[model samples]
Target: MFNVPMEVLFKVWRQKPHQSPQLQTYKLEVQAGNTILECLNRIKWEQDGSLAFRKNCRNTICGSCSMRINGRSALACKQNVGQELEMASSSNNGDVPTITIAPLGNMPVIKDLVVDMSGFWDKLQKVDPYVSTQGRKIPEREFLQTPEERSQLDQTGNCIMCGACYSECNALTVNPEFVGPHALAKAQRMVADSRDTEVEARLETYNQGTQGVWGCTRCYYCNAVCPMEVAPMDQIGYLKQDILDRKDAQSSRAIRHRKVLIDLVKQGGWIDERKFGVFVVGNYFRDLQGLLSLAPLGLRMLSSGKFPLSFEPSEGTKEVRSLIEAVQNHD
Candidate 1:
């Protein structure tokens, strides 16, 4: 019960397309259980009529109210004023607590706290995230799945498409072509669905290059920012596993990366960095084209004094080998 209300200050980001961005502070008296969205509504309704933000479902399901609260991507509709105050206080050594609100990152801000999500949607489409069919005749009845197959869909099916994971994705920042985690997470739902018919074609499409699951840096920020605990990174991992199992494109660099990383880590305590590229990208220097493909980068590294000449076995090889063996055995 919010018997006593507290005055909280929100330093919200303000910007319009083709204009400068700034933080505008609004001090409001908010009740304890009031969500950050409620406080923003109060600010717009009472203090500032010109303020702008996006919201549809006041509940967390619609995911329209996703924004950065205290430098982390979260649903403003789900985070209460009390929790934000605690975070702000702890982060700044117990001074007057101030909430820092900003638009989600990695997308062009269209207006104050509103980002253009055309690219996000485009990437989702690139994955062909929907279930595919070859237009076969419909069954007499519904195409049903067993409980065991259905259970696999549970984790990824909760995605609300909030773009929180996309906002925080490090891989997308590095490679703009990389599909965001939201797409991959939803794509996995279709991948696991027993009713889907075109599983092989889907796997082949996703296995080609950095544009798919391979582009992920595995930073796990997508998992951390997700409000529904969809764990997009884990979903991407599942997609990777599926791709590997299907062997759709075994010669793909993504496959090579996984294969080489494991083999190298097993051989030495860690990646040698020297033999990694030669082994993975160069196909162990066996494929002349692969070796020639890396020639430019290797020459650049050599000229810049960055290329490594030799690598020795790591210090804790035995212990590392045992741990690797244990994990392999468990699997």
Candidate 2:
């Protein structure tokens, strides 16, 4: 932390309900020890009383201060002015260094640096984040879990529902029905709990449509911006693995896509684009509707000479197959 004060430019996104949003710049001389939240507080207290944002503990725990800082979602309370200035300097080409603050993405803004989290909460509810009702029946004492079982819940339990992961989720941006990473991370927590009797039901629900775990595009943006180091994308992967282990390819096109992708890779060390669509989306021509849905894309690919007519096995196919089999066996 620098004791010397430095003048930093803050470009904050300003929007009121039913108003066009724009950046409003604020100049402040701040010490490096001051957090982004502190600067925001100073701005509101001294510079602009009309400025709107949310805060609670003035620390990271409450997660109320989550917003975009320098183009990425994070908790403002956790970010120091020093770190942001250094980051801004690197990208600013020696121009005046500036920290850009905006409300979290993938949610509607209520005001400057504040977003409506109703959708975030609704998606979280869809995952049924609570432990199974059966497991919660009035017990004589606390429900117990082994050390190993408890360990599995540690990372996901760290989530404070800050909406950072939700803001960065690419799938949620395009597919409103897609439950964001925050929900799936919580779902994984419930699934990992030994006391949860609804394990199968939860897995089935998570495996269901684009709204569930299958919807994740694996962009890893959620993981990158998570404040608590929850690594939500990794939790989503665990959910997928659990479903893939129990469910067959015929369960759903999503399952088929995963199974076929792995099978093709095992056979040729990489996906066979030609066979992939047939087996996955088309379900080997068993589903006429699925086949019909592929017609437009198939015709376009063929017309553009982008369709592969033949398949060639990779030189390391045997090694790839062995590695996959080893993982399966270990599991």
Candidate 3:
């Protein structure tokens, strides 16, 4: 006896007896304030008791119900079905608004909407997420931090580990070894905390192999999909800045690349590939292997006369310098 204007048809994928996945569609009338999680619950409890999905703390705190809603990763508990349907309807794709629910990509699916979280937990463990303070007397009550000191860790603490960001990340698509955004963001949080005295050790932990923070492409997908508005991309940027400030030699390659970019923009209005290659290699003979790899392309550019041998600083140098100074001062 319930009347509603909008109805959602969810095309849910479930595992079969042979371990194959199959899609099953279900239609449900949606109330004004109903979420996707609510719709799934109604379908399971009333229509088919065997339906499978995971949910806890329907208020978006548990992060257990992350799935792909219409090809994008979203927390089902936090996403409003009616609103998303409306948005999809308004799009110019001219397709019917049907929610396609699937388990998060790049992880093993356990069932209908559940993914094996062992990978996520394992990555978290590798980062050493907890604070490792040096030998210090125990506090009388609890470890206290100043307001300014506490604010640094606030942004990363908001991450609910929803994995939506990881699901959409392009770096993870290409480089499976790279540590995803959540782990790097967590590492940055601890590094910035004044109470933590093991900053050097933490940086070393984050810089291990090509899978560390330095491998991040700074794409900001993590910032977009976060339901709690935690900017993981910003945290990564902070980590990069911290690395540069420390002048770590292992991070010198990234520093050189960034400097090349800045120098190119300052000297000219655009980037010079020839100069960039030189900057990236640093003493051509030292990186003779890399130089040989790019020899063909470098020769083509040189022959084309597109490569500039020398250039003068642009008039915008002062402005760019000021901007860089502002960022450093603020951080």
Q: RMSDs, each prediction?
A: 3.2, 1.8, 3.4
User: Model 2 over residues 22-137: C-alpha lDDT tens digits?
Assistant: 98999889999889999999999999999999999986899999999999999998999888877763545245567889999999999888899999999899988888855456
Q: Name the candidate that leads on TM-score.
A: 2
Most lDDT-accurate candidate:
2
Please, what are the lDDT tens digits per residue for candidate 1 over residues 191-271? 888878878888787766888888899998999999999999998888898777656324766787787887888898889
Model 3 lDDT tens row, 1-331: 1346566577888873349898898877776478889989999988988887889899999888888887778899988866677566442223335777888876777777778878777887777888866535664547778898898878789888988878877888888887888888888888988878889887766755558877788777778878888787888787777666776333556666766676576566557666677667643346777677777877887899866777666677778767766775786
Determine which window of 10 residues in candidate 3 has minimal summed lDDT: 88-97
Using Cα atoms with residue i matched to residue i, what is each candidate's TM-score against the true structure? 0.87, 0.94, 0.87
lDDT of each: 0.85, 0.90, 0.76
Which regions in candidate 2 have their CA more than 4 angstroms from the true location? 89-95, 133-135
